[model samples]
Target: MKKVGTMLGNIAMYFGVFYALLYLLRSTYNFEVTLSFAKFLSRNQAMFMAVLFTLITLVYLLIFRIKGWIWPHADNNLFRVAGFRRLSAPRVWLMVGMGLAGSLFSIGLIVIDDIAQLFPSVPALVDDLIKGDSAVYVIMGAGILGPTFEELLFRGLLFRELRKVMPVYVALVLQAAAYAYFQPSMALSVISIGSGIIYGSLYLRTRSLWAPILVQITAMSTIFLLKYAGFYAWYDKLNEGVLYFITAVCLMALIGGSIYVWRTSDQGHDWIRVAKARMADTPSAAPKGG
Candidate 1:
């Protein structure tokens, strides 16, 4: 129970610091963005979030140094526990394929009006950036930086912490729900929850943050590029039957490819070894609180 409380506290602290930084920056810049809680998440969120995460990461690293907190050796450090490890070339290729298919599959989800209604800001932000002559920056920020940081926070920190106190399956669900909590509407929440589960599974199954991070970056880049090419406009003109057929094919590819990867991937064995090492070290690693 104590461990659970500490985990929960850390989750809260992460998001709390994020929002506090957002508020501070907004105030410092004297941006005319509204002060209302409802409007706090402006459309420029991706760019600002990237900045905030960079700042937070720097601060945490500095604090760790000042506190003389030496990271554990390679197999036991926070980075290791958070799934920051490598994968075989085949596994990496499989993850990239999965990401591509998943992004294509997501078009079906996006066309569901209720599910994607609240997500317009993402494309809108991208469009705005492109029009402002910042296309490259938006891609780097949204496609790479944004997804990397999210994977670090949600799949890395949240899922790792949850695994310490519960079975992996339970932890997966809890972490997914926690990730979805940031969505503003129930429909979007459901979508995010589902996405979180997929990313979490990728993280655990591959035993490496690289798996999910690559998948996310690939998916975001694919979608953004498709959007930039005006594919969505062409898609809108398709007959319902053709659209359904394409969506079904994409879903089949995603599901079938995912199953293949899950069966063939050997990285989970590494995670099991890491978990055992963690269990062995837990007692000694606990703070003395003297």
Candidate 2:
């Protein structure tokens, strides 16, 4: 019974958040109640929702700590796990490069508007919601709130927990799939899922939640800027010809190459050391040398 309960708890920990999100969306957008809980949420309570979700994630982390379900560190270096010093220059640069690459890919899709057409429902929904004094709500939701909450939950909590139960690759792919399902636009869905995988891999490699958080925030901010500058719409009008294809390909290749180099270089080794050290500090974690 204890084993069954643990299994159920694990499943609920991951999928329950997702279920809550779906319920929030459906109740607000799909049904037509006079009070329109969805409108109310978008207008007045979006920040509350974001904070609530963040708190839920923190609670899960606390529970896991109490249960001794934490990862082991590499060398028993307490210094590596607790402070900003663990964040190295290479890791930061790698995250920035990855973020830029993701931004370029998303921009290419937007340029053709091929991405927007994938989710014909979203623009109308967005337009309707932004009609009143709530225009800033869209910006806050997408740019700040969504990235902060979603990354903390998915990359910070879910991926870390999943690593304890599954192989790293399997954990990353599953997280990415969840990210895709949550996206409102299909094109954005693909980008989100792909970026989720990248972020997951970085987290696994670096063992620092901060790395992925920075990347996610940067990517989201770039998207918001493009949208605000009208570059997204203007790109749609340009010819989606050979030049555009070449440019996209080249940009993607550069980004991928940068990530590859970073992962393969000495900086990657330092991050691995830091991760192992952090894992060692948890109560249930084995000693670094052991």
Candidate 3:
């Protein structure tokens, strides 16, 4: 029964957000325009959606809490899994490097598409969505709200619940896969999965939601700026021949550098050990001062 309820909760959360977004787009904008705008939203509006969705989910969670379906204090430990430890300089640098590498990997795909003349339709659609005065909407939706809510739900809550049913790696993979599927863009779907892995790994290592959230925010911000400045389109144009090859090499180098920094960092071992350890410790080491 508990498993069934939990499964239902997962399904509800995922489909609820999907339907909500679909409804928002359908009711708020023309299908063609909304489709086009989705790309921009992905780049810009994602954070907004994330924030809205997370808040709505929190409300639902609260409702469950009030009904005695779930207890806030009973599962308080799960919510506090994002241990509030400060990251060391080495870990910080390592995460930044990894984040850059992840960005490069995403860009490298675009370069490949350019070389093959297989550019995705999503960007053009996004471009269409922002064709007029509503451009600011896209910025707010993507830049701020989406990142915050997504981290809160996906990395923070969803994964925490999942850890109860599946192996850590399996749960991470499943959550990441689900997250990727929501994007509705093959490239982004792939990127989301990869990012899920990185973020999930970080969460597991540090037992801190902040680490993944920070990385996600940084990534989304970079994407927003890139799109706002036409860098995405520019790169799409350079997707062929020598430039693409050079870009790919650079991306690989970036990945290698990030891995090196992460492995050598002091917090790297700490995170790794924590991730491997059982979920025995609470958010803090001190006794619950009841």
Candidate 4:
């Protein structure tokens, strides 16, 4: 329980730092300059957010390195410690395929009034956030950079911390709950909980942070692409029968993709085992001559 409290505190600390810096940056200018800058930021909100996320990601990485939280010591590499080891090419494709399938499945659910209808305003909020934003900025920020930071924090840092004191399943739910707790809206919170569990399980299954990161990037980018291509507008024109058929197909694909990912996932070896194997093969880790 104490460890869980500390984990929550860490999450709070990260966000607290983020918002504090944001406030300072936005308020540092003189009144007239601040007003003008605020107007500019409002217009280029997506781009500004991307830049801010990039800065914060770098800052956190540096802090973790210095504190030995990510890097640990001179003997350890940051990427390896943080679950960035290479995955097989085939598995990579499977992970991405599953992610894409899941995205389409979500869309089908929304179209069929199976999910998004539960949170009535989420669609409008999403539209407002992305519809008028610059395509490049929105894709870079929300699709790529945003997921990178989140996966690094939740599945990478927070998950590691939780795993030290609890079983994997317990850690999974706790971290997922923490992720959801920070969301700005109830609808997003609900969605975040689900996505968080998926991402956390992906991390554990693949034993690599890249798994969830790639999957999330694929899912979010696909959604944004459909939105930009006016897929929803076209969907509305379809008759109920056709819509139901398409959604059913998507549902089947989602189930198939999930099965593929599960079957192909490298569950036999965890990061620790892989690292030990690598070290055992290294000449430096061999026994010294008498």
Q: TM-scores for all candidates?
A: 0.78, 0.66, 0.65, 0.77
Off by over 4 Å in 2: 1-8, 17-40, 43-52, 55-86, 113-136, 185-189, 250-258, 265-290
lDDT of 4 by residue, 91-134 (tens): 78877886687667656555655456777555655565584347
User: Can you list the residue pairs that collide in candidate 1?
Assistant: 83-209
Output the TM-score of candidate 4.
0.77
C-alpha displacement of 161 in model 2, angstroms? Answer: 2.2
Which candidate do you rate higher for TM-score, 1 or 3?
Answer: 1
**Candidate 4 error regions (>4 Å):** 1-13, 25-31, 68-78, 113-116, 131-133, 241-263, 270-290
Judging by TM-score against the true structure, name the best candidate. Answer: 1
- C-alpha root-mean-square deviation, each candidate: 5.4, 6.3, 6.2, 5.9
Query: Distance from true position, residue 98, model 2, in Å?
Result: 3.1
Q: How do these models rank on TM-score, best leading?
A: 1, 4, 2, 3
Model 1 TM-score is 0.78
Writing each residue's lDDT as its tens digit, candidate 2 over 1-290 gives 54335434765765785567556554556667734666666564444445456555555555546445444322233212211135578768767666665565656654555544765554443344334444465456555666766766676655544544445567679888877877766755765676777666656555566666667666656765666677666666667784368447745754574467446645435644534443333543322211
- Pick out the ten consecutive residues of candidate 3 with the lowest summed lDDT: 281-290
Candidate 2 local distance difference test against the native: 0.56
Locate the minimum summed-lDDT window of 10 residues in model 2. 75-84
